[model samples]
Target: MVASQLGADGYDHTLGDFTAAAFTARAREEAGWLERLSTLEAATPDDAIDRDLVLSQLRGWVALASWPDWRRDPAVYLSAVFTSLFNPFQQRLKPEPELVAAAVSRLAEVPGVLAACRANLDPDLAAPLLVRRGLDQARTGRRFLTRTVPSMVRDPALSARLAEAAEPAARAFDELVAFLEGFACGGDWRMGERLYSTLLRERELLGYGAAELHEKGGAAWASLDERMREVARRAGGTADWRAVMESLMDDHPPTLEAMRAEYEAETRRVREFVRSRDLVTFPEGEKCLVLPSAEYTRPVAAVAHYLAPPPLTSSRTGVFFVPFTPDDFTEEEVRQRLRTNSRAQMPSIAAHETYPGHHWHLSHMAGNPRTVRKVFRTPYFSEGWALYVEKLLHEQGYFDTPATELAHLDCRVFRAARIVVDTALHCDDMSIEQAETFMATKASLTPGTARAEVSRYCAWPTQAPSYLTGALEIDRIRQAYQGSLKAFHDRIAGAGGLPLGLAERAVSRPGEGTPAG
Candidate 1:
């Protein structure tokens, strides 16, 4: 089946076959490491040691795959694979403290691994595995600091170990930077198409193959543009949609500190509102903390994101990371942004990243009994859920203020525009310039922001469309269920939360009629 998909060109065959072979080789190489950790756990007979063993196994899988280019900027390829293969297990073990602590310790070693990745790193020999390591490090570091550290403080020894781990782990970040610089210097464009294709398949876990995704992405792009035009009309914008968007940026800019504080306050306020409104039930013994984004990741991520809660056993709490990129903007400009990304839009983002979005979804999935499914997450499902939440919040009147509504619409337009740009750049024969123009004009992105986004789509294909495609599918399912149940609120609350795989199943299920209104 994999061969058939590769076709006559054999690029897919070579890449896919080599990757599979590599996966086998990596598993074998890590066996001894795993065994050693298991031995350590059995011999030491302490919760912390045992937990460390488990984390070692996870990190070992990540470290063994670390390659130079893969380590530097791995959002596209490596992230997809790790999320698919490891997230499920990570989720399952999230509730356990010993395991969470062990995971944190393992993650703390990432910076060291990056430091170890040097300039002489071979792309042919190193590219395939490098990212896996960096991702593992980043993932582990994020999991430990964001999820495990806060809760596990109850254990003095464990707390001390975690505190000690941060410095070395942070030092590892320099290695990461060194490895990335090497990658930028030596990496070729030849692997771009192959890497992009592999990422799309792995992340979506769809049977349609790479070519199909590209084709669908192209088609969706056109469809979404038409939709956005209608939205623009509704907003009474005719003086070039891009101009209208830029105006918004200018109209509402805020100071960096102010922006950060506003976002922080808004997130808390939204969570409180959700709880008070009986929108959803948040579990006990769990908390949320918002921090500044790390240097390495701040380049591409949005202003903020939700780091999933640590496993139940770990002392970690979930984190909402918001980078303080003050250097990137002036004080006045930053202040304008504070008002721009105000209470209205902030709540929806919070909803998407926390509460009923990624954090909540992942937390639940991690706790589910299906261990295999827990480990294997589909980006389509996960990303789709967050995108769906954005619209859901808007629909549920979370964006009650006009400014907030505009903010929500702004995001929606941005997403709608993504479908177009993501598809055109990859499959529709659009140039980088064309893609950039489309984003700037249709999505209302600034020149700088639009250019960055275009680079991202070019580097990683089919990801942008996932927001729109996934949201559409989720909304469709919700509508279908509402039709059958007739009571919208009751139906949503009663249906329980849908896991990624199950959501796909429900969407793909034959003879599934649209929800009856």
Candidate 2:
């Protein structure tokens, strides 16, 4: 579905083959492309950078073939199912009938996909936590197919067609859930130090390895911890940052509706703030919609998530999904969810996920003429920019109040913790239990949230660290920049979500635009 939307023609009507042979063939094909790219000569500076970006991505694809995540991770198939099906509904790039037809076609393919996954996944190689997480997602997938999907289409015939396709799809998910429930996961989740190091150096094009990244995270955590302590002292005349952070949550909106309204308002307010300050340029025809998380995404949704517009489409509208407190939640659970998304923290989240963060940065990325820049974004650039801008806003006094400053610091501290936890988990330095404990204690996340965070790290190695690693690298670039802050921001944003190494090169040169398509 993503490929279909992204101009990879002929994939809209059916799910791609996910068999072992199919994956082996795809890997070989990517390797061939890598070889072809190596033979090309760049005619300009931008072309050189674009070539390097494409090379790095292809290297990642070729390298990952040896690891074969499909054989070890059930979540990979779950992610495929959700992303392929859900994106069409959210992006809405096609007409209603077309979108519904695509969903129905994909839904019809779910059984085969799951059967292939079952055959490919080695019970001895799947980690218990990963399997459990997959089980949870499969249950949620079942609910999404049966309940939410039918209600999305307006036309009765299309809706009925979707519903018909959904029934067997939900059953497929049920079989997956049952399969996972009965299994004993014997594999370790760790990618090991070598593969983790390779991903950092080769895939991300970073200067350092996993160990260095972990060390950097530790240093950053210490710095942010002190900042949080100082801000807590100023916020309520207490050096107890944790206590102050807890206090801010009590000031949240009374209801999720009001909470979402606050996020919408903050998004608008932050956009205006950026405009007034002449911050990074916004792309043409860009807008962001603040709305509730889709039913399918609610299982794995963060407090705030930014869904970018499909780059192949003309629309530059981004959706900021703030999940509602679920109706099934106990009162305390509802309050906990609301408090985690506190009033004081919404502005920082708005800045991180919307204006001058994901929405603004990604809008520029979507507008890039080069398809490589538009399609192959590293989290190191995207997540990094979002995180980097949060600090930029704080330094510029966007978090004017002591409460908001404390809240922002708390988030920074959490990202810093992520650097540590992510490295530890992938490098075999921490167990899943220990990582969850570290998050709950060190980052002050609730138990449930902490488990969710660790589970994500286990499933997707090196991703959690991208938030801080990218931000810190960008900060290094900014420290040496000679231009005005706004100019620096524009230069970086104009680089279009390249690897940070490429971004630094782009920022250093004068008058460089996006690489020509």
lDDT (10s digit) by residue, model 2, range 1-517:
5587574656878878889899888889999999999989999888888899999999888877767888888877887888777777777777899888878888999999999888888877777877777776787877788778777787888888888889999999899888888877698788888888888888899989999999999999999888888888999889888887888889888888888898999999999988888877777788999988776655555467888887767778889988675456677776777888897888889999998999988777666677778878799989999999999999878899999988988888899899899998888668889999999877756676777678888888899899888998999999999988877887787678878999998888873465222
Best by lDDT: 2
Off by over 4 Å in 2: 5-9, 325-328, 515-517
Model 2 TM: 0.95
Clashes of each: 44, 0
- Residue 348, candidate 1: alpha-carbon lDDT: 64
Poorly placed runs, candidate 1 (over 4 Å): 1-24, 27-112, 119-241, 251-253, 272-279, 312-316, 326-344, 427-431, 458-460, 482-501, 504-517
Residues 395-511 of candidate 1 have per-residue lDDT tens digits of 667877554556566676677677666655554467778878877676555565676577666555566767666776667666666233223322232222333334534333321
lDDT of each: 0.49, 0.83
Q: Please report how far candidate 2 places residue 294 from its true position, in Å.
A: 2.3
